[model samples]
Target: MKHIFKFLGIATLACLTWSCADIDKDEVGDESKLPNAVYIEGADVNPVTKLTVDAAGGKSSFTARAANKLGSNVTLKFAINEKALEKYNELNGTHYKLLPAKYYSLSAENLTISANNISNGSIDVNVKPLDNELDASTKYAIPVSIASAEGGSLLNSSVTKIFAIDRVLYTSSLRQNGFYLKTTFNPPYTNLQEWTLSYAIKLDQNKDNQAVLSPDFYSRVTADGGLQMKVGETDDPKAFAKTKLQPGKWYYIAWVYNRQHVKCYINGTLDTEFDVPKVETFTKLNMSWGAFVGYVREIRLYDKALSAFQVMDNLYIETPENPNLLFYAPLDKNTGIKDVSKNHHAIKVYTAGSDDATEYNQSLITWQDEKFPE
Candidate 1:
């Protein structure tokens, strides 16, 4: 009887020990085991990121990260979610137009995060250079979302990332329907010896004789059906290219003049060169009906005669950063014109019949939908 009781006691003790060992193993093993929920590490903190680039073209980048470390490597896939972009635009009161998917490309569409990399795993997404065709006034966006993860679950709330391209205020196209800009020469320009005038123009119709740069005494014109530059009181005009101005085409026109010589350029090519009498002084510029009748953008004036290279360099108005630039008018304003140069000249618009003596009265200059000439 004593032996039987002893045997029963030992069996019960052994069973109890085995059960406790099993419980301990489950607690120790599963304590560090976490559910795989992957997400962009900075998505919650910075859900939206902004990028800016020149209208010319440039690249931008962003990053995504996993939520938890894993025992093995895992591949993650990402895609641009158009619906999410629309939602973001609506919520943020933004008109973020979606660029094509080709614009937003990932360095690795299927990024693999290894076990060691899981702790600090991240994937880079590169946005291809934006084309110059994009509208300067419009903001664009691309929303990236985690599509899938091989060994992890995606965090729904933090899966999406927003990237926006900032808007750039660039040159504006002006319609010919009687639109012109005049500057208030407060400290009127005077005592001019050497000067260079450059502008980009597109004419819808040619005028028999029209002033392009008329500053009281000195004038450059499309006179007698040709590009002309006149100096002195007698209007001794030097003409170039008898061919009529082509309608709806862009032309870069430049005039470099001094006391001894005058040079004209069209589209970076020297059109004409001649000797001219020196002019001692001149007044403000007048760009009314007799001056412009079509789209004119990026008008610049230099105090010194620009070299051939300088004129060619400024053919495309990328940025207004010339040291010798005295007056620059991007003419990119929606309501009124502005001189974005060191000399902030006052710009005033006028109606055709306004009694105001200082105003250039013509049809109101309306802003064109396209900022550049088509």
Candidate 2:
């Protein structure tokens, strides 16, 4: 009798396992389970985002549900305008294509089946020679679309973000005459956020042999001495050290000072800070990444103070390959400058040849200033 009972238990367990396996397979076939609610009615498709450089890369992802209440798998299609495609496909194209700029169309083969456009999916993408006007201030439309194969119905369509590429500085080097931050008097403003400087700084090193790059550098070298803050002596020029600023590493220099406190960030991390002066007035702030020459790409300025989180997110595009710590590896030994501005503006500088140290304006965010005036 004991042997018979063991056999019956084994049989029951087998039945349960088979039943569960069968249900799992059915879920993939049913599209009703997918959640999406969107419909594309017109021929005009909204662009997802605009890119600045001739070679650009980015990712786009969103959720969608089927049209009818019935769950049925739908197909998605992402395509650029024919003109954009033809331009990229040109022979011996003078333009170069780079990652995050490569075009691609992905489909799950009826992956979504649900009531309305109800499903979740995402795709990573890139584009080259993005059919944008040569002007940096002008905005261009990048058309994107989604659709189902069965009924051939189109879904979501909307413009993404505007893109701005800074005016290009075709020269070989920037002027060495560094700009001073006048923080003490007018103090740098949030409007200074997008401005970037890429030249190397010559340190007048101290006993420690370490050259210091301070947060107040923006205000210290400025016409006004330093900005007003709550603590510490703003006049302490030694607030910085004589540390080596290495080449091939990317650093973000900001004119970051306000009524609360004065600070500077390196690669999205806080490297220096100073107390707010009691007088509440200072200037002559100075800052730099590399001195006299190096490389700078994607310089931008914003009108507001960016929180740490916001700055990190914006800087992520160029954060890969430890770029913030070191330079990006390129096909040639020369370093590659990734995107500087992520949201609406950016600067990208790539070295075409070796030997000449690339220099840019440390004071001007826009390319309108003379980098290396003839």
Candidate 3:
């Protein structure tokens, strides 16, 4: 279970979509046989309450229901309670901020659970993250509760339901042996003055000393025991240590190299900037992989140095149709690695050992399909 406990709170009634006077109590039930209780939908069966709103925004709804069917109609009023979320954060030791009212509005304000319907109308939470735009890095949530009830009673402490919000752009990724897969550039990997590479990943394990992303001859390790990103030469930049890359969280990282300057952006924001002594313009840009534990569906390589704005904009496009893109791999499709760019580089898995008559045998690597990125 992603969550085990929930908080209970009382909030002021929110704006209602319809009046309770208009809703008729239609159904008939035997008072002795029916369970006389009112609660939020799905309160009995604990569910991970997470809602991810894309730039296009999203819509989700939950209703108030009567356990079984009450003998008469029970009208319930719901509202958003920020304190409940604060209490939840205190209990869970998390720092999730309250979603602003402008980005979201409730539609399930007044629901009447009548004899005809066990579960009545819903409170629709519509979120327009892109309208004003939400900070992609911080966690946000909404705590909803039945503010008031008429002719009914609340059930078993099921008052408030908290919904965590996410703004993940990468909805698809995979782990495959093709992880070690590579393809030689048509023009080859030399004399590159400016370049840009972007990757979206969700760390799967906390084990350190493992290389999670190897775009070419350059790769980053789970250095400092899976908390830091190793830069320069293979996993040696101790100075670049930072407590980033937490497991089970998604991150969109991009590296831009121009002349001797290097910049790293995490989740569309610039995180690292430094000057290096002529970075690797790999002529023989290839690799043999080890154990890499993460999900990656968005991998891009461009010949030109992309600014922070460009890197931020790139996160929204699934398959960008651009002339400068040298290699683009969505990695969400099935069977065989595919480059969706104009180059359409032929991916080939190479043998790292002595290339004799193929004697040493090692199981091949391939990527497996995963859930659409959350």
Q: TM-score per candidate, in order?
A: 0.50, 0.36, 0.48
User: Candidates ranked by TM-score, best first?
Assistant: 1, 3, 2
Model 1 residue runs over 4 Å out of place are 1-171, 217-224, 235-237, 241-243, 333-336, 353-364, 369-374
- Tens digit of lDDT per residue, candidate 1, span 1-374? 23333544665575577774664454522423434566776777777776544455445555555544666777778888889888875664445668767666666666767774553444555565666676543456778888888876676777888776543344556554443456657676667778887777777666655556666544443533466666655555444543446767777888787775878888878887877666544456656533457777767887788777557645645344445667887665453467777778876665433433556443455656443223
**Model 2 residue 38 lDDT?**
45
CA deviation > 4 Å runs, candidate 3: 1-171, 177-179, 215-217, 225-243, 284-288, 316-318, 334-336, 350-373
Quantify all predictions' global Cα lDDT against the true fold. 0.62, 0.33, 0.61
Among all candidates shown, the one with the greatest lDDT: 1
Number of the candidate with higher TM-score, 1 or 2: 1
Q: Model 3, range 160-253, lDDT digits (tens) per residue?
A: 7877675654333555332355556755666678888777776666565555455443555454433333444544354242436777777777
Q: Using alpha carbons, what is the TM-score of model 3?
A: 0.48
lDDT of 2 at 145: 39
Question: What lDDT, from 0 to 1, does candidate 3 have?
Answer: 0.61
Is candidate 1 or 2 superior in lDDT? 1
Using TM-score, give the best candidate's number. Answer: 1
Candidate 2 has an lDDT of 0.33
